[model samples]
Target: MATAAVFLDRDGVINKDKGYVSQIDDFEFIDGSIEAMQLLKAHGYLLVVITNQSGIARGYYTEEEFMTLTEWMDWSLADRGVDLDGIYYCPHHPGKGIGDYKQDCLCRKPNTGMLDSAGKELDIDFANSYLVGDKLSDIQAGQKLQLKANYLVSTGKVLCEKGAEAADGVFTDLLSVAKAIVNG
Candidate 1:
């Protein structure tokens, strides 16, 4: 039997999109995020967080700091009965990256590298899975893999624009999207 997942874009979908959230103190969850995650998990969707951490490549923050915040977020979610099956991120910026981080890597969102990584590592049924993101890049990333559904939340840069056309659904936030996923 194949497994299905709900791929989430971390920055805006999981937490606030106040730019690069590197510090623990700066981290904050969106309202109903924990409950939504738990609901998805209860519905048998393996929660996978896929984010693009350009701050890591831009020298704005170190990968260690990113990892630290991520670990803290993971535990925070776990406390609420939302255990993520996987977390993947990209730390590359072709132009803004510094030194080793400077490169046009395929793992970046809108490239599908991260989705491919998750698909290969897990029993992900891409054609039957769902992706919820706050950016156009996130939609393009999963759509490239033929995901069952793609949703864009009105919480990031893509808002106020016609990003709705790119997604299967558009909502005020992830919780609304999760509601449809869990109930539908």
Candidate 2:
């Protein structure tokens, strides 16, 4: 039996999606995000982050700057007693990207590269894992990987629309997702 995990999409799901957020001041953690992570952690689920950061590929920011901001974010979450197990990001875009980043990458969302890597490296049971994200691509990624559930959050770019049928479940915010995960 492999360990289970909760894969999270960083921008929009954990933090407010403020377009290529590269600074500590610009990184705003969404309400209840920390608590939700805490809940997952308490339940013995490894907390992992799989995100697409095309901003780096677009030259909006550097990888070093993204790491700086990520360090601050990790500190913030640690202060709240929620330690993330790992974070994986793909800085690639098929278009509008520079040089090495111009190619399509498997680690990007809608692909299971990150999840597969995390599963292999961290011993995660893909069939027992769950994913929470704000985009249809996120759901597709989890579905393709056969995760236990996928919760599409209506907090940022992927707002909930009537008759927009895609995800296994939908929530208004990360807090709502947490409630469903914990209560069920």
Candidate 3:
């Protein structure tokens, strides 16, 4: 009775990582990402965005700014006929955080905090879920949760060392992964 999900990393995977994007003007979707998402939806996969918004912790941006941008993105996607199931973000960084945000938390990627929370709340089947990330921590997070597959994308920061080993496969972008998912 559990539904399958596609865990997505915000920066590099969903939107262009324009250096801690906190403003709507800075947020840009990767080409074809919206179309790919439509395909995923048609195939019946719940879409969840799990991101690390360390800018909030580092005092680079306020929580309100982040929320505003998030709302814009979600609304824009909705206009394109794609509605995300859940959007979860961790505003923490152990070293760089200024105040209460400074802590080593399990919600960060490579840990399964965000993923586990979404699964419990959204009825996701972890073993059947898939993850698409550009960083090694993203792949590690899905691996720790033992998802069906984890893909490393060429966009974003593109962690190459340990991430390659952790990833189930590497792709040019999210659209290619979408095609593979729809066809596979």
Question: Using lDDT as the measure, which candidate wins?
Answer: 3
In Å, residue 51's CA in model 2 sits off its true spot by 0.6
Total residue pair clashes for candidate 1:
0
lDDT tens digits by residue: candidate 3, 55-76:
9999999999999999999999
C-alpha displacement of 39 in model 3, angstroms?
A: 0.6
Q: Please provide, for model 2 over 129-174, each residue's C-alpha lDDT reduced to its tens digit, 9 standing for 90 to 100.
A: 8999998888889999989998888777845553136677888888
Candidates in descending lDDT order? 3, 1, 2
Per-residue lDDT over 109-143 for candidate 1, one digit per residue giving the tens place of the 0 to 100 score: 89998888888898899888999998778888878
Candidate 3, superposed: residue stretches over 4 Å from native: none
Q: Order the candidate numbers by TM-score, best to worst.
A: 3, 1, 2
What are the runs in model 1 whose C-alpha is more than 4 Å off? 158-162
**What is the alpha-carbon lDDT for the whole of candidate 1?**
0.89
lDDT (CA) for every model shown? 0.89, 0.87, 0.92
Please report the TM-score between candidate 2 and the true structure.
0.95
In model 2, state the lDDT of residue 13. Answer: 90
